[model samples]
Target: MKTERAISDEFMNALVDDQLDSDEKDYALREANQNTEFRERVCELRALKEMVQHAYPQVADAPPRTRGRTSLRLSHLQSLAACFMLLMIGGTSGWLAHDISSPASDNQMVHSLRALQQNDFGIHPSKYVVHVDTANPIRLKTALDEAENLLTTAQDTSQPSQVEIIANGPGLDLLRTGISPFAQRIALMQKKYPGLDFMACGQTIRKLKEQGIVVELLPHTQVTPSALEQIITRRLKQNWAYIKV
Candidate 1:
């Protein structure tokens, strides 16, 4: 003989409603008799059916008010929660927009002042000076000639009352042994303008001697140890400006 399996709730319900075939109903009853839990569940279902039949009249008289109220309250709470979430999102988006749109706020006036200071018109003509420190001897001579021309033009126009030419560093070659190509022009400028000063760097002279180049003392030229410092000192103390070309 084969052992019977337990009856499921579906099988019990089918058997109770007379929906099962004879062979299936017999099998379900055999299983239900073997399993105590299944038998108990079937008995409870039968009792519930009888009570539901007796209570059908009372259930028809009442409406589902409690379920409807519960649903309404849940909808209201969900709407409130959704509104709060939207407000938070909107606030966060507003803050990000403000941060992105705002311009640089710190040191704005200071930056504007710095830009004004760098403007070309801030410096005056009398405060200007020129320093020539060229590497090539030919270029040095050419620059000297250009300076002389500029001085003559200034003197003719009387635009710049003060102009000085300080030649130092490698530019000392202009006053050294070999006769400069622009010697005649330089001599003429020196004779024409008494205020034009041509000075050489003493440091460059020492270096030139070490390199075995002879230094000849010239009449219109002067020498100094710290040429760059002297230029800076004159500019700052006497309101003289600088031109490097």
Candidate 2:
């Protein structure tokens, strides 16, 4: 018996573009509701479509040009502008179609390549900075889980992605020696992924010391003068994707 064909990117694209027929579209919609990966892919397609449309809108009722033909005399500037737009569209479409191929459980990054292409972080070994500013113990664990998910997803995409979590404000407790409830888990995670970083805030530590609170950093955790500054450094200096938790 022939293997049943899995729904493809083209089918998902059609659903996003509203090009599928009623019955087919209905089936695809149902699949999307059940399949998280399909749903995320549909969303990515819609977002890329909107980005392209916004960047290069076709003028209504404009006469189509034949190969190497123009109805009116073309200026050097207009020719250059047309060439640039064509290049941009070609680059973005090719990158998007090629880069995002994976299961939804591993592929949480649905960001447009255009966003990364603007910076220098378009390639593999992508650096991601997870920022945690809340004091909630649950949120810290959730952020770490999401970071690990993103790391695994990146690896599934065939690129080893780097991840670091920066915590400040009440979030600094995530890395504090005595007060953090999740210290043991953090230590275990560090042992598992030696490259992952859990950075504490020096500013917070100083404040806690002034209040007569002892601040001890867990092993494998680094201390930074400022969390926000480190985030800014990652964005501007290192081109790391910053996700706030």
Candidate 3:
């Protein structure tokens, strides 16, 4: 593999926020595809963004204190704080060998899920929420595969389990009526595992509708008012294991 070129953190932040212009976006996307480290950086940045957004849902609605510039600076500080927290948790380790032949569940997200389950103080590891926010085909498939594995393990061990797969942003495509590539597989999985559930973010649906797109979910898929709320409030706070794809 060719040595990956360095990308500035500021450029990465802009890329994640969709603020990159045509040429910059093209280069960023190309780098992300060809460079494993670059791709991981993008994924980590996105995870941090989501973590901050969910951790402080009211920040955007809060009134400015003295001046608009002050408010903006405060928001920037908050984001930096959240980014620091994520970095602390992720550690300053070098990239691990990522074998494409291995199951997608063998990635870092699944490692975190397993660690949480093993280190649970008192919370049982029966409830799991697999979060999907990207339209990437590999990740979408991994989300389903991971959910199925969790449900299957619980079933085989005779342990009660409730697994919910939540989709938002571009990942909402995974639950769309006609857009989902795994519609039939999803239906089959539902029939196979009664405790398994699928949820589509209502906010994402509304946004799509605002863009003049008709939003319809697959049969039996539920809609949550907000995906972040469902994850942070309904699941995480309730002690559910989280797996991000």
TM-score top scorer: 3
lDDT of candidate model 3 versus the reference: 0.72
lDDT of 1 at 225: 67
Ranking by lDDT: 3, 2, 1
Which runs of model 2 end up more than 4 angstroms from their true locations?
A: 1-125, 155-158
In model 1, the clashing pairs are 127-241
Candidate with better lDDT, 1 vs 3:
3
Superior by TM-score: candidate 1 or candidate 3: 3
Candidates sorted by TM-score, best first = 3, 2, 1
The TM-score, computed over Cα atoms with residue i paired to residue i, of candidate 3 is 0.60
Model 1: residues >4 Å from true position, as ranges? 1-124, 177-179
* TM-score of candidate 1 relative to the true fold: 0.44
User: Where does candidate 3 clash, by residue pair?
Assistant: none
lDDT of 1 at 125: 51
- Give the range where candidate 3 is weakest over 10 consecutive residues by summed lDDT: 92-101
* Residues 138-207, model 2: lDDT tens digits: 5688788978888678767877667898887778888878888888878877776655888887877787
How well does each candidate superpose onto the true structure, as a TM-score? 0.44, 0.50, 0.60
